[model samples]
Target: MKKIIKTTLVLLITITTISCGNKSEKKEADSKKIEQTEEQQHSSSENSIQLNNGNPWMANIETTQGIANMKKLMDNFSKKENSEAYTQLKSSLEKEFGTIITACTMEGESHNQLHNYLVPMKDYFEGLASKDILKCKKTYNELNKHLAEYSTYFK
Candidate 1:
């Protein structure tokens, strides 16, 4: 009877050890799964920041080119000092800037991130129509500064 009781106690201990090991293995697996899920969420957020087609830098280059073209148009008007032509040119510039703002604002990714650049651009153009030559020149410089910073994000 003593020998039988000893054997039963040993068997119970072995069974408990095996059961505890399985529980520990299951806990480890659950922890790993949670970690993988978190990593996937992080990756998706990063992907969203990237432009569609995975070439966000290209958009920045294009935006810079557009700003350069606008500056050139403004320079020509400034050089000519033709009030009538300047008036029309200024109006066109405002419209183009408005379109750019609308497009940028409509974008899903990085819209808020880009608002600092776009808002100043809009404000500068809004004042262009009535600005004197000196004010226009100042605003042009300001616009160029903002565009330069904006372009750097792409680079």
Candidate 2:
């Protein structure tokens, strides 16, 4: 079942990415659709990321590097906490997400587990897109916690 979900996710992302191309006009709409799909998948599956039989999952170098870069981006945005910095963080994160996906070398259960971990971050990123500073700050706090927790599952 997990494999089926992962396969579906990969196909959806590939189709979305190809169809959207470089059109910024449709990027936001496409992102919302992807987010909704991820949200549904996350809710239907395990509530949180699982351990690999009581140990952290061994992540690929690109995945680890991308996550580390995203953490840095979030940290930098935290220091500013302005609309500009928030926008920059969101943009940087989107780029890192692409990097992670493109450079992914993991396969089988490990890869599926990685997707399970990534899906929820999309929600927080969506929240960061809002215009409300207070709400963004709140979401930022949650996102920061989520990023910090990444090391516990993936190395």
Candidate 3:
């Protein structure tokens, strides 16, 4: 009797586990509703010219590339050199900045401030390569100032 009871219990458990994998129609409908809600939350920037904080270069690359990566690199900067992060940053900068610069007129009002911010970013990478921690920190500060100026004017 005990053996029969154990066998029946195991069979019941197995059936229950197998049934759990199957989604009810209600569960499937709920999932579809969640997906639809998520799709509606995104913004549609139509004919929009976004500034890089305040630069005439139209758009924020930082957000697109996700500033979290930059924040991570900066936080771990002194530990060891990250050539991969450096390379990725440079590549993203080129694509984003190139698109921005190309879209604007050469004589745009915020061109100098915007361009100045871009140049030192490369300098920061160079400083990293040469192990000039002080110089790299200083360059970051300078870049910060440039960006502040950009924000003041273009926005």
Candidate 4:
């Protein structure tokens, strides 16, 4: 299922690019979709948490708010029979994942490496959001191992 989702997303992105006519136009469109300056890219949030400085798409997820929200969402995900809440949280997480990857696209070869790392995390996040506590715990542990690596290379 995870593989399917990843494959589909890759195909969709490819199709979208093909539909857009050319690579340069797609890059322009993706960038122009969020028009932020380099300074705005890494602006500190109210909590003084910095987002990814390399891409505008990372502004929301790399912040303190994003981390806090993810924690809260994971906590809520453990509740029994909370279908409605899971629905909302899952949607939000998926949207944020999109933002993260789109930001990756702005960086060329780095995008490929980042995409490789993030894809599995995205799958785990989806699993957690689906209210699978065991999966969530396992994924969280997996994420901890990768966090340092992400920080080291992404900057």
**Per-residue lDDT over 76-139 for candidate 3, one digit per residue giving the tens place of the 0 to 100 score:** 4443344444445445544555555555453453455445445545665554344454554555
Question: Of the candidates numbered 2 and 4, which has the greater lDDT value?
Answer: 2
- Steric clashes per prediction: 0, 0, 0, 0
Which scores greater on TM-score, model 1 or model 2? 2
Residue-by-residue lDDT tens digits, candidate 1, 6-112? 99999999999999999999999999999999999986664433333544343444445556667666565654343344457667777666555555423444554
Judged by whole-model lDDT over C-alpha atoms, candidate 2 comes out at 0.84
Error of 1 at 100 (Å): 2.1
lDDT value, residue 86 of candidate 1: 43
What overall lDDT goes with each candidate model?
Answer: 0.60, 0.84, 0.50, 0.54
Clash pairs, candidate 2, are none
* Top model number, TM-score: 2
Question: Each prediction's TM-score against the native?
Answer: 0.44, 0.68, 0.34, 0.39
Q: Please give the ranking of all candidate structures by lDDT, highest first, separated by commas.
A: 2, 1, 4, 3
lDDT of 2 by residue, 16-81 (tens): 997777676588779999999999998777656788998889999989999999998877664445
Cα lDDT of model 4 by residue, 1-155, tens digit = 99999999999999997887787788997787666654456442222322346542332234324434554555555543454555565676667656554543335544444555565666665664555656655655555454434544444
Better of 1 and 4 by TM-score: 1
How close to the true structure is residue 105 of candidate 3, measured as C-alpha lDDT? 50
Which of the two candidates, 3 or 4, achieves a greater TM-score against the reference?
Answer: 4
